[model samples]
Target chain A: MSNTQGNLNTTAEVGIVEDGGSFPPFDSTTYPSQLLWLVLSFGVFYWVMSKVVLPRIGGILEDRRDRIAGDMAEASRLKQETDEAIASYESALAEARKKATTMAHDARSKVKAETESARAAAEEQLAAKLSESEQSISKITAESLSHVGEIAAETTGELVKALIGGRAPAKAEVAKAVDAALK
Target chain B: MAGNSGNAIDPIHQFHISKIFPVEIGGVDFSFTNASLFMVVTVAVATLFLVLSTNRRGLVPSRAQLMAEMSYEFVAATLRGSAGNDGMRFFPLVFSLFMFVFVANMLGMFPYFFTVTSQIIVTFALAILVIGTVTIYGFFKHGAGFLKLFVPSGVPAGVIPLVSAIEVISFLSRPVSLSVRLFANMLAGHITLKVFAGFVVMLTGFGAVGVASAVLPLILTVAITALEFLVAFLQAYVFTVLTCMYLADALHPSH
Candidate 1:
């Protein structure tokens, strides 16, 4: 291992110092080319990044942000419209319910008034007919009593004539006698 | 051991610089090397991932788009948290640094790939850029008052100079620490992984007992590789966070 180490050291020294007369990294001969290339490549890279790539990416990000904001605004606006529609519909429903209740109340009151008036008219007509019927009944009763007195006077006259051979009482006196008995 | 003196067991060989296309501009060698290729590849991959994933711009993001957006938001939040809203002016630079370092580290995790952040020069250059921006912008924004960052308030008059001197020294050490932190982490992690792997190879060459014992280093190598992945991400985050804090000082230099 030591022998290998020694060999490795010698090989490294010869390769680094003798072949290039200096370490490759510290070699002055390669500086110009390295610098030249570094400047050129790095310059190009910077130019491309600043001028082209960065702006496009930034623009994409910005555009996405704006679109999201705009979409959110549109969504909220639609929600607001929907909310307003619901509120209006609810109010309209409440108004219609109120109107229906008022109409029902008015119809009930009108029906009740009409029914009361009809009942009163019917009772008044019944009362008038009943009074007329009572008057007729009393008149009929008086007429019937007069007839009965006449009948009775006839019967009596007949009987007396039979008994006494042809004597008949006057009708007026008979009717007066029946009236006093009826009273 | 005697036969194995090649670059295979040499851990440092992986960091070697070999030119693919040798270019000389006014007698200076600015050749495109493996390091350069990886840097370009890193940028390409990061750019492609970001661009292609976000091409659709789906409001509900796809997996790829989510990953990309998360990365962006993560860095953005970090920057905003550390430096406040005013510190967002440095977002591009901070994001670029983070992506570059992160992708570079991840790409280097593959076998036979160059780790760009492991290069001191590269990390140093990045650190210098950060510190440079902080210094320049601080001065430009606050004029001479930017120097007040070193002279914190509430110190007694006698202790003010001592406090300021210490503060100045600490402020200057920011770049050194920042650069070395990333570079050293990458360098040490890779070296350790390579050495363990080399140990596996060396042990395996010693017959049946060697092969049986090589499992320890092999397992350790695997674990270290996993740990390296974490370090890659952590280093990137650390670098960007520090960058934000430094930029905060630039924007408000009082304390």
Candidate 2:
């Protein structure tokens, strides 16, 4: 490979050269055989690359693409389901809340209605008891006033009998006089 | 070899074409040369790299598998971007071309190894195949309208013929430029390195002065060698992208 072999390389120039003719690169003798080899080698590599290597890489890429698409689709579906679930859950909670509010309102109204009716009934019972007691008290007061009048007239007769000795007024006459006085 | 005879260090001599095994049929030489051996080696290495790296074909890639997938995606993306999804049909061709050229150029970087891409005939053959495929695809797909590729739509009536002629000439010169670009780059870089290496060898004489003088060429040789490796990969990329553009033209004849 050393270029000191003067007899071997005569066209080697010191600086950059242009197109070559006398150099081996310009040789036309080996064109056909080299071409034949090129064709064979190129054919083999082409078959391997197109049929084997490229297809494998393409398959990998396609697989990754499919996998990503599948994942995205799955994620979106799960999101939709989750959203639906949330919506249903919220609706159920709202329904429960509405039902509980109605029940509480009904219980409050029931308790209020019961309290009002009970107070009205207790007040009626108290008014009836008061009227009965007031009638009994008036009757007792009338009977006691008659007793006092009788006692006053009887005591007056006894006083007259003691004072006038044997000259006491008749019982009937005395009652008539007492009655007039009471009127 | 670098003595007074001055016959040992000839940079161009390394590219000499010689038959490793001599064969002749119909007065035509079909003999295998060092170039053929390296071509096989190129094929072997390229094929082996892909086949072994992909033998497992696991989801989590090893380094080799990553390398394999990277090259595959690199060419695939280039073709797809340049020619659209339909260009995927030509993925195998583009991938093979990239790998072959890249491996051949890299192999040439080693000592005592032949660079197949440095040859005009080899690069010319590949270029012709690409151009031929593009032309055939254009005609097959678009029929007679494929010729419209040579005529721009907005040219004035007076300048149409002149513009058409220039465009047609440019279009036809694609293969020449394509092949020459890679061949010339490889040829110039390798020849420069050989020349500089020869200078280093030649300067070993004259005692201290020779030693001091050899240092410059040695540094330059190192720098140029590094630059050449970069050029090797760059040329391969340029060739592949250009091929994709041509393929694009084939698919979309208007562009």
After the best TM-score superposition of candidate 1, give how far the Cα of residue A113 lies from its true spot, in angstroms: 7.4
TM-score of each: 0.77, 0.74
Query: In model 1, which residue pairs have backbone atoms overlapping below 3 Å?
Result: none
lDDT of 2 by residue, A56-87 (tens): 76776566568789999999999999999999
Cα lDDT, model 2, residue B153: 85
- Give the residue spans of candidate 1 off by over 4 A: A1-21, A97-183, B1-5
User: Cα-based RMSD of the predictions, in order?
Assistant: 6.6, 5.9
Give one digit per residue, the lDDT tens place, for model 1 in B1-255. 552455677787778766667788998888777677788899999999989999999989999999988888899999999999999888888988999999999998998787999999999999999999999999999999999998898889999989999998998999999999999999999999999999999899999999999999999999999999999999999999999999999999998
lDDT, candidate 1, at A95: 100
Instruction: Give the per-residue lDDT of model 2 (tens digit) for B1-255.
Output: 342234235666556655556667687777676677778889889888887887776666789988887887898888998999999888888888899899999998996677889888889889998999999999999999998888778788999899889989988999999999999898888889988988888898668899899999999999999999999999999999999999999998774
- Give me the runs in candidate 2 sitting further than 4 Å from their true place: A1-21, A67-183, B1-14, B194-226
Model 1 TM-score (2 dp): 0.77
